[model samples]
Target: MELPKDPAMLLSIVNMKLRDFYPTLTTLCEEMEIKETELTERLASIGYEYDADGNQFV
Candidate 1:
């Protein structure tokens, strides 16, 4: 499915997937066919960065 265009929604959805499904952002991106760079840049637009230890954006 296509991702939410809204940044807040994107953050929520990505975080949820990260928390429940993926072990790492790289895995998520590869399996889900999302570009890691774009995902990071999108979240970074709203001041969220991936925290690898927690596997979530903060």
Candidate 2:
């Protein structure tokens, strides 16, 4: 699936999915058909990174 083009929106969507659905970034990427590196890179551009312990991008 195509994610939001805007980083902030992407952060919100991904974080929500993380909070409500996925157990890990890896799981989310696999089930959602997203690239781990690409998602991290996009969110990193906005100064957010995945905290595996918290299971969210903070």
Candidate 3:
């Protein structure tokens, strides 16, 4: 699927996917064929980072 181009929207979609489906960032990225580093970096640029314990970007 195409990821949101807006960082904020990307954060929302990623967190939603993590909450409703995947167990971890790695699994989500793997299943979606996304590059984990790129995803995290994008979100991080907007002051959000993945929190493994919560399985969401915070």
Tens digits of per-residue lDDT for model 3 on 1-58? Answer: 9999999899888999999999999999999999999999999999999899989999
The better-scoring model by lDDT among 1 and 2 is 1
lDDT of 1 by residue, 14-45 (tens): 99999999999999999899999999999999
Model 2 alpha-carbon miss at residue 48, Å: 0.6
Ranking by TM-score: 3, 1, 2
Q: Report RMSD for candidate 2.
A: 0.7
The root-mean-square deviation over C-alpha atoms between each candidate and the true structure, in angstroms, is 0.5, 0.7, 0.4
Clashes of 3: 0
Residue-level lDDT tens digits of model 2 in 1-58: 6899999999999999999999999999999987899999999998999999999999
Q: Indicate the worst ten consecutive residues by lDDT in candidate 1.
A: 1-10
Q: Which candidate is the best by lDDT?
A: 1
Report the Cα lDDT for residue 3, model 2.
94
Q: For model 1, which pairs clash?
A: none
lDDT of 3: 0.94
Let me know the TM-score candidate 1 reaches against the reference structure. Answer: 0.97
Highest-TM-score candidate: 3
Q: Model 2 Cα displacement at 3 (Å)? A: 0.6
